[model samples]
Target chain A: MKTLSLRNLQKTYFDPYAGSQVTAVHDVSLDVEQGEFVSVVGPSGCGKTTILNMVAGFIPYSGGEILLDGAAVKGPGPDRGVVFQSFALFPWKTVLENVGFGPKMRGVPKADRDRIAREYLELAGLSHAADRYPNELSGGMQQRVGVVRALANNPAVLLMDEPFASVDAQTRMTLQEELTRIWQERKPTVIFITHDVAEAVFLANRVVVLSKGRVLDQIKVDLPRPRVWDHLMQDETFKRLSAQVLQMVRSA
Target chain B: MIASGQRTGSKTPGSGWVWRTMNSLAGAAVFVAPLLALVAIWAIVVPLFEVNPRIFPSVASVADAAADSIRDGSLIRHIGASLLRVGLGTLIGVVTAVPLGIAMGVSPAVSSFLTPLFRFFSVLAGIAWIPIATLWFGYGFGAIVFVIFNAVFFVVAYNTLLGVSTIPMTIRNAAASLGARRWALLTEVLLPGALPNIVTGVRTGLGFAWRGLIAAEMIATNVGLGYMLFVARDFYRTEVIVLGMIVIGLLWLLIDRLLLVPLERATIERWGLVRRT
Candidate 1:
């Protein structure tokens, strides 16, 4: 069964200043099976993030239905976790506290939540910086905290919106590797959104190319598992897949 | 950064309480030194110029009056009375203002409709209320306290409204998506997020309240610092008036430096995220 499926989803935003209705996502439909990684890649302003936000339940859709395991999504719940592009870690909280916030909200005991947070922080290689404030950490470290904070919720679906867009290239590569390793172990249904073709190809099993407000094509990435940067960067298949995604995005 | 480092430096492992005490004492000396120097200059200038006692009391005469007031316990009585009025008024103002402000702020239509009204009232706070207060409550503690209360309420409410309303929608959405309920959202997200602004409101409100208290005391009350100053004006007793002025100045400095300033600084530190360069 599909963990997440969108049927002809649409969103129309009323631009009050412009005095007109603008459609952000038009007839976009897609699905992700349980434990699958799907990356949605497109040019800027292609409504990819809008789709992610709707799935995360941060925004309302004008039409269509989003089903999770045959159940309709009512509103934002603990069932779907989201990693924001801006790394929206609460400034007042420490690394441990921010990571544990989800479990705490779910009424988990302090000791248990702390243990869960510590384990996830360990997975992100941030166990040593658990007590530090968000502002005191590097951008990469803060994003790592953001990822674990979402993961600690144990949501059935994980939505990532260009989670590494703000970091330096080297840090982005490192975070991608860290995320891939963690995702391999957990194997949650993930819908990752990005504009970078190489990044989308590297982390996803399937790449959905979006343009303007619709999906242009969905390409299956048959790259080998436990994908290594050195090997993947030089592999012919990786080059071909990335080139195809880049061409589609450019044309769209 | 350097100042915060010094403030937190005393928390070093194995640092004794005595060392921390000495460190704060040194910090206090920086403020005290200038006041002492001003007093020395006053003492020298007054006698050197042979200034008239009626116009400005000499340092010795002011000192004598201060000692006499203290010995007679009138100084403490007047100070205690004024402080009690401000305390009661401010307590009522803050308790009522915070919740009402948050409620109004939660709704956009109500908040926008009330913003101008709040701004108008806050601008007219303090002494403007004194006449009506005295007329409504009679000339006494009730009138004086009413004036202080009016002074604090409008400013605090307006600021709190602004604080709560200015919170980014993104943060609220983030909390909701993370499974926060209404109560949790208010207590954990809204309150903490608005605290820095609330503290700023308190500081500003208290400033207005302090000024209003003195003005109200002069007009309505019979036994406070402003009353003491006004009564001394009739007898040309410059020493008592000067003593009252000094006491008022010192009290405000003590309250702000010890209470409001620290509160503001702590909230700013707790909520103010310093952006990375």
Candidate 2:
């Protein structure tokens, strides 16, 4: 139940070899209303990840401000949960414990957190894997845990950074469907970052395409609810929007 | 009758564990057979050649020496003293090294400053410390323990730094994003991520500690397995010398196999942090 705003965000870092400051994310501004799903998609080096990283507070922005629920962002905190490209599940912890970690940090009692963890696991259809370690699961399953782990924390906005990129294609499709189902069920505020054009269009209510660290365009998808690859694969609007985003990305 | 017997066998308690235990016993036998054969050859060779006891005691004589030491309780006292020194030294080494290692890991400046020093000492670490250590502590428990501590400290600290620094950045980011504040991040992410390397460091460092302890004991202590061997040499009690040598070898083997290997394999492999060949 929060709105996130990024105002003229910019990132500049000195390249060691170049020996001069280079801007990674140019002045890009966007706003995501409460419980809205937004996808920021672009080619590599387009600063899509830089934007997410700055929003997640994993790195500092050189200029501009990020506000979540009207409060300015500082360093990393529990309020902004992130799903990494690498899945980043703790190898030593069981799936249940990983999901419960954020709640534990909030000092939720063991029983209460366990309940919370169980609920999230069920939401992700991972209840059976609750006791298993991350390494014991497949890459696709691991990322499923990764998504729910971020969600269970009840962050103001969830930031996902190309989370499904490492998995196989079939699994990726299934995961995309599962994610949409979970999103529709929970209606959490999300800012999902990906480079895949079709994925950006398919998953989001609004798609923001970045080109050369700047906002190239923002396309709002009017596709009907319950978006599934099965139906959307042949849907004319889905194909049109996807082609439009893909054309922009390729041109950029 | 055969079918009934099969049913009873299947119902037996811990059948899987029982099979596993049997497999381990067989594996142990396979490993020990060669060592036992070497011992048998020694037993035969010494008496058959009428080798001088001063040169090397017969297996019977060595066995008798072991029995005598056991009966008099000197062997236990010597072993107990050596173990205590090693345990205390290693304890201090690990406790002190972990924090310093973590500090260096978190800060590049600290690690860079101290890393060259570590590289130099890693080579010069063990027995070489004894002369200076004895000079400082004046030839007693302090000096010997200092040598053991030096042996363990450098390796564990260096490896711990390696461990902490090698942890994937994404993992740390995940923890931070998940609401792990500074202290929680240290205990949860950093510690667990660095565990496998830290365990390896302890194993290698303990090896160094054992060798250093013996060498230090020979020079700086009046008691210990090393001292026992040295005194036996002075009297030409080859039996006791042989006994002490065997005991040192056996103790190290026992510690490695029974404690270190299991610790590394059990927890680490279960976590899938390491793969066993």
| C-alpha lDDT values of all predictions | 0.87, 0.90
Model 2 residue runs over 4 Å out of place are: B1-14, B275-277
Poorest lDDT segment (10 consecutive residues) of candidate 1 chain A: A128-137
Candidate 1 lDDT (Cα, 0 to 1): 0.87
DockQ of each: 0.49, 0.53
- Extract clashing residue pairs from model 2: none
Error of 1 at A101 (Å): 1.6
Error of 1 at A141 (Å): 1.6
lDDT of 1 by residue, A92-165 (tens): 67788888988989999999999999999999999878877787788999999988888899989989999999
| Candidate 2 lDDT over residue span B1-277, tens digit each | 2232232345654465677689899989998999899999998899899999999999999899999999999999999999999999999999998888887888878888988898788778889999999889998999988888888889888888888888898999999988898899899988888888788988988999999888888999899999999999999999999999999989998999899998886668768888444
Q: Is the docking of candidate 1 incorrect, acceptable, medium or high quality?
A: acceptable
Which 10-residue span in candidate 2 chain A carries the lowest summed lDDT?
A: A127-136
